[model samples]
Target: MELDHLLRDAVRRLADAGIPSPRADAELLASWVLGLSRGELALKALTGLEVSGADAERISDLVAERCRRVPLQHLTGSAPFRSLELRVGPGVFIPRPETESVVEAVLGQLRRLGEEGIRRPRIVDLGTGSGAIAAAVAAEFPAAEVHAVELSAEAVAWARMNFEVLPDHAAQVTLHHGDLRRSPELLGELSGTFDVVVSNPPYIPADMVPTEVEVREHDPQMALYGGGEGGLELPFAVVAAAEELLRPGGWFIMEHAELQAGPIAEHCAAQPLLESVHTHRDLTGRDRATSAVLARAQRGDVAKWRA
Candidate 1:
């Protein structure tokens, strides 16, 4: 079989299986089998390269697995986040493109603070699944000190693997294996020290099931849902944690479900430590992230907020 022809057939199969972005998925799977990047696969396919029988069979098997809704990132063993490729599999929640905006908001705030001569900012990523955000922050800001907290041992293994692969980036990031809701002893009385506290925590309501089989079946349950109604419990916890962890005038960036945007923003606004609640839209124009700034010296501790 010819490469482009095989790719077209794979796209048809994936599309028929109801996968979104079938062509992109097909190309990516083929690229993996061909030992090429997706761009390289596209170019090589146009050359009408002959597909070897072994490679063709491997592609067919991969496509079939994808048709079953196993995550493409799981099959490829990595997912792209910003410039880095994070290792992902059964335990970790693959970092979605939407969460990149959450990271960007933090990076943007860092740049603005740079103008004010606040270089080498301190950052902490709560629920740092696969260490995606932590690694990205460390890579982008070499001077920044980053700490990441995760609860799942399985997920932590994947994060550790990625950190090992990207030692230069992970060198600046400290990984902690503990629940985000409970501050680990590892943090060592570090409250009110971070310049930025960010997370893409599990914000899906516990009762709700994801439409995709990959997410519903493959993604870890603990990484998918927040406790209580409307998936706001964990997000609320995240806000409170950020308020505690961030220094005065620090920033908090987090991703949440689109529908929960208003409530999440309101929760942040209610935090005395956090002021200026700002919603940020994803590429699809959905409200995907929220950022709030901590109040400077004049404001008293707002930890006892009622609303």
Candidate 2:
């Protein structure tokens, strides 16, 4: 089938399956199959570009799997995030576009710090699944030293692959295979050293099932559910870890569910070491991330590492 006809049928199939952005996803898959940019694919589609039979068969299987609510990134074996295409598959949480704005938030803060004569800032990403945020920081902020922590071997493997593709400053970044809950133990050597501490940790509660099949089924549970109480437990620990890691007057930014704005802002603001808590909204206007400044060095919650 020709590219236009193939994408049209795939769009219909995906839409019928209730997939959002069917045309975009379909076009993206076509681009992946041909290794052409979406814009390039569109230009070729205007000329009725013919797809080879072998490639057509592969595209069909991918489209079929997408219709079943499989993640497009999973099918393409990569996810685009902040100018980088990250390798992704089972056992790793796929990077979402919303988190890109969180990276922007950090970059904005980095600029603010730059004005204050802070160069080559130290940064750490807790629970760095697929190392998306960590790698992005390393690539975008050339001088920042980045450290990433993850617990799952499978996810860490994918993160390592993603880190390998980072164009610059990746060697300045460290990937630690350890649990965030044990930040006190695992990250003790670097305690109170980082200028920026960030995370997009699992914040979904155990009882709250995700509506998307891609997330609920394909994504690893360890990368989804926050432990206990509305999945706030893990986020709370992230805050504590950030508190310990951030130097006085350092920054902490974390992505969480929209509804988590209130809880996160309130809890982090109350911490003696963290202040100026503010929630940030994504492009869709949902409260997607919150930022705070660590005001001082202080001991806080300690927990066993289950991850």
For 141-251, candidate 1 gives per-residue lDDT tens digits of 778888899999998898888777665754587888997877534576787778889999999987788988888999899899987789888989888787778778888
Task: In angstroms, give how far residue 181 of model 1 lies from its true place.
Answer: 1.0
Worst 10 residues of 2 by lDDT: 298-307
Per-residue alpha-carbon lDDT of candidate 2 for residues 1-307, written as tens digits (9 for 90 to 100): 8889988998998999999899999998888889999999999999999999988888888989999888988999998899888899988999989999999998898888899998888888999999999999888887888899999999999999988876664467788899997875787778877889999999998889988888899999999999879899999999988877777788999999998899899998787666788889999999999999876433333211211
Error of 2 at 242 (Å): 1.2
**Model 2 regions lying over 4 Å from their true place:** 296-307
Per-residue lDDT, model 1, residue 75, is 98
Collision pairs in model 2: none
Candidate 1 error regions (>4 Å): 167-170, 184-186, 298-307
Backbone atom clashes (below 3 Å) for every candidate? 0, 0
